[model samples]
Target: MILSIALKEWKLLIKEKGVFIWLLVMPALFIVLFGTVLGNLGGGTQTLTYIDNDRTAASESLMTALGEQGGFKLEAKQAGELDDQVDRIREGKLGFLLVVPQGFAEKMTAGGDSLAAVELYSDGASDSAAGIRSALQNVATDYREQRLDAALKQAGVGDEAREQALQSPLQIEEKPQNATEGNAVTQVVPGYTVMFVFFVMISMIRRFIGDKTNGMTARLRTTRMKPLHYLLGMWLAYLGVALVQCAVLLGFGHFAYDVALGDLAAIAVLVLMLALCGTGLGLALSMVVRSENQGMAFVQLITMGGAALGGLWFPLEYMPKSMQTISHFLPQYWGQLAFQDIMTRGDHLSGILPSLAVLAAFALAGVLVALLRFRGFMKSAQG
Candidate 1:
């Protein structure tokens, strides 16, 4: 009986063109658009335009050193262009410019504790300005070390003394502790996948409401189909739909973006639990709303509001602390967190048990609610 009803609902959903648009097409577009934009944001070389007024080996060496250490492609602009570049910066057209003053080499050559100024003009709003600033400071520190070496030699100190004098007391090392490296694809693919899963509620709500208004719910009682059986059948049908939707979205991410999916067993289990949670909520909502419009409004609220608060669009840490705490109560947050932990950290099924348990609890709660309200929902069949 369950299989027969589920098959009927599935065929009806397949006939609706909007189901494909909502479930597959929309999410694919989001993944492509966001993935491309963020993937290329920091990919290419940034040009650092400069005017070397010193015109000597010291100035040339400074430019070479800056280019090598700063991760930038250096471009030489004539001194005549400095004023135009400054104006462009003020007008938000240019990002960075370096000016080695005429007396810079003279000061370095004289070398008795005199400071040489290297002017860096940057647009106040530019994000790359800090990187350039820090690089220039490092170059200045190198020159200062050169001066120290010379002074030590003049004072009859040995090379050993100079080496000891210049050695830094602190050294910092960066260690990556995750199995897979994180990138824009990791963020966007799983993010939108978890977010759009909730949207399956809209279709479920519409179908359940349509059945009630058309007298399909009450009429089913004339057959062997019990009310609870009908509810379970509808939930089972949409659970399959949500599972297929997740599989397609995740598969698209893997193929199109090369997103690494870890722990296949964990992923499969998570998808099943996610489908149950989504369809279970839909069943509960289907039995509660008096009208399709009212149901859609609630769905939009849950979908959009949960997307924002649940770290579907961005990292939860980006939100305020209070909001982050609140997101713990949302199923979307748990789903997204589990996806990230698996895809990025290589968490297995055992590691994701807490998330799985939470989703199960939500599914159980929703199913209980649906069972309690099914009779009232049947009573309001307008058709």
Candidate 2:
């Protein structure tokens, strides 16, 4: 009997044209738009405009090194073009401007106590400005070392001593704790997947409200069907729908973006727990609202608000410390964290146990609340 009711619910959902748009079309659009646009923005190379007033072998050597390093696309402009370049930067046509001062090479190679400075003007607000500055600093360091080596050789320093003198006293080596930090695809796919899964709440709440207000539950009371069977059927149906939605989204992400699923079993557990939470929350929300209009309003508030505050729209690290602390109270935050652990951190199921426990607690709390209120809500509707 439960299977029959669940099948009926699934069939009815499939027959709705809007279901496809909500479950697939909208999510696909978001994934492609953010993944292609913002993802590229985070990692793409910057273009730099430069006026080389020195125009000597040293300056040419610096430009050659910058080009070979491949951090920035170098655009050489005459000194007269400085004003125009600055204007373009203000207009967002360029990111950075470099002025290699006259006698830069002479000053750099003179081996005197004086310091030579190359003026760099940039849009401090630009995303690529920091990286470009870091690359330029590295180039400057290499060039300074070359000049120092040449000066030392002219002073009759032996080859072994010159090499030893150039080496830094302290060397730091960096190793990535997790290899997937800057991957844009991994960052976005899990965020939107959790977002759309909870969106199923809208459909579930609508069905629940319709069942109560449209005499479906009253009619079912005349049959041998128990209320528990009816509720179980609805929960199972919605959970199935949520699981399918998650699978499809992750599958699309894998194929389109080459997103790696580190621990498939852990990811499956996380998705199942999240779906259970969604189903339970939907059921509880239905009992809280008296009408379809009320249900719709609550649906929008909870789903959209949860997605925003729960780290589905942006990473928690980007949020203020207070917001980050508050996000722990949200089920969506735990869901996203679990997904990120598996997909980004390459963690096994053990790593996500805490998040899973929180989600399970949310599911249990929601289901218990819904069950306790179901009888009262139905009686009120029937009366």
Candidate 3:
């Protein structure tokens, strides 16, 4: 009997164009779009103004290094116009500026104090500025090292001699247990999984709300079957669909795209938790909404907004420090972070316990709330 009801829900969902488009077509399209556009967008260039007061050989060499880095388009401008350039930066026309003060060339040659100012002007809303800043700082460090090398060479120290005197070089070797987890896609898979499952579940719940508002639920209740049985059957059906969809996506990521599934067992636990949460949330939403149309809007705002906050499509690393701090409050963020730890960091169960605990809490809370609300609705309907 439950199987028959589930089959009916499945058939109805399949027939709906919106559900079909969002569940299957939309996710596939996003995968393709991310692969095409964001795949090659990491090395974004920054527009920077160059203020070269001392056009010495060493300064010129530093400028050449910056130019050759190809991460920035160096614009030659005056220091006097720094304020105007800052205004341009505010207007989103520039990333940052580098100012080489007077006597910089002489100072480097004389092994004296050569102070160069790099004005990091960002709109504070731009992620690219951070990357540009990091890359440019590296270039500056290299240039300073080269200047030091030249000074040592003039003082009778050869390249081999300077190499021997270097002390305490920091070497950080990142070795990923699963190479796939090292990338953005692998780390973000959990967030994506949670987000899409929520989307699908929400859509299904909206359908349920529609059935309730249209008196289909009450009509069904008029039969010998109880409302709880109907709701349970519907919840089971939606959970089954969510599980299947998650399995398909994971399969695609693993077999087709070679995306990492670091620990299959751990991933299974996470997916199961997500399925439970989705089912409960979907069912609860069905009861909360007055109608399907209202549910649709609510679902979009809730699921999509949560995904964005949780860094499903992007990383929280791209967000500001404050935003990153706030992300911990989001359930999706906890799930995603746990997945990343397992997949990217090769973390064991112990390493991911906190995140897993948080996810379990969310799942349990959602389920309890849903059951309570569902029971209340059934009692009211009976009364």
Candidate 4:
């Protein structure tokens, strides 16, 4: 009887084409969009436009240094264009401009306390200005080092001593670990999957509210379909929905983006647990909410707020410490953690037991709440 009811719900859902658009198509688009965008964040060159009033070897050398050190594309504007560049920055159309003073070459070669007045005309509102400033500082440091090297050479210092004097104390090394490289696609795929999984509640809310409003619930009481069976049947149907949703999303990530999904068994188990958790919450929501509008408000709070706080949209380390601590309480966090563990860290089922346990706890809690509310929910429907 429950199976029959679930099948009926599935058929109805299928006929409503919006369900597929919301559950499948939307998430796939989001995956493709964000994955392609955030994946190439560090790939492109940032352009630096400069006015070289000095028009000398030293000014050109500084420009070359900025390009090399900052990985910036060099754009030389005539000194007459300085005012125009400044106006563009003021108008928010440009980030910044570099202006080398007329005496720049002479001051730079003088090598005393008198420094070249190389002005970075910039808009305070610009995001790129900070990076450009840092690049300029690096160029300044290199010039200072060159001066120091020349002085040391004049003072009869050996190559080894000069090298020892010039070397910086800080060093950064890039070391990558794990079974698969972590990138935007991996983050975005499981993220949107977990986020939209909660959206199954919206459909449930619509269905339950429909039944109650249209007298289907009252009519069901006259038949052999018990109220508990009705709840279970609806829950079971959405469980299938969530499962298919997760599978399609993960499959898209795998085949389309080549996001490595390590430990297939572990991923499968996590997806099952995630489906249960999402659908269980949906069931509780279906029983608890009085109207579709109110249910939608709750769904927004759950999906959007949870996505932000649960680290679904980005890494937890990027969030505030308090937020990171709060994320542990959300099911989205556990779902995402389990997915990243399986995909990036090469974790198997045993490795993800904690996240699975947390997801299961949330699922159980939701079911228990729905069960407690089922009597009242049905009573209202019958009236």
**Highest lDDT among the candidates is held by which one?**
4
Sorted on lDDT, highest at the top, how do the candidates line up? 4, 1, 2, 3
| Candidate 3 collision pairs | none
Across residues 82-119, which tens digit of lDDT does each residue of candidate 3 receive?
Answer: 78977877888776666777777666556456555544
Q: Give the Å error, residue 29, model 4.
A: 2.0
Ten-residue region with minimum lDDT total, candidate 3 = 179-188
| Model 2 CA lDDT for position 372 | 93
Local distance difference test values of all predictions, in order: 0.88, 0.85, 0.72, 0.90
> Considering summed lDDT, which 10 consecutive residues are worst modelled in model 4?
38-47
- The lDDT of model 4 is 0.90
Runs in model 1 deviating more than 4 A are 41-44, 218-224
TM-score of 2: 0.88
On the 0 to 100 scale, the lDDT of residue 188 in model 2 is 75
User: How do the residues 1-383 of candidate 2 rate in per-residue lDDT, one tens digit apiece?
Assistant: 79988999999998997987997788878888888886776466667678999999989887787777775678899999999988988887777888899999888766668677888888767764676677778987887788789989999999999999999999889988774674666767888888888788788888988887788888887789988888899999999999999999998999988888789999999999999998888888887877878878887887788888998877788999999998899998999898988888889999999999999999998899899998987676561
Better of 3 and 4 by lDDT: 4
In what order do the candidates fall by TM-score, top score first?
4, 1, 2, 3
**How well is each residue in 1-383 modelled by candidate 1, as lDDT tens digits?**
88888999999988999999998999999999988887887676678889999999999999999898846889899999999999988898889889999999888887556778889899878676777788888888998888779888999999998899889999989899889998888988988888788889999999999988888876887778877777878888999999999999999999988899998889999999988998888888988888899999989998889889988887887899999999999999989888988999999999999999998999999889998998888766645
Backbone Cα, N, C clashes tallied per candidate: 0, 0, 0, 0
**What's the CA error at residue 8 for candidate 2, in Å?**
1.6
Best by the TM-score measure: 4
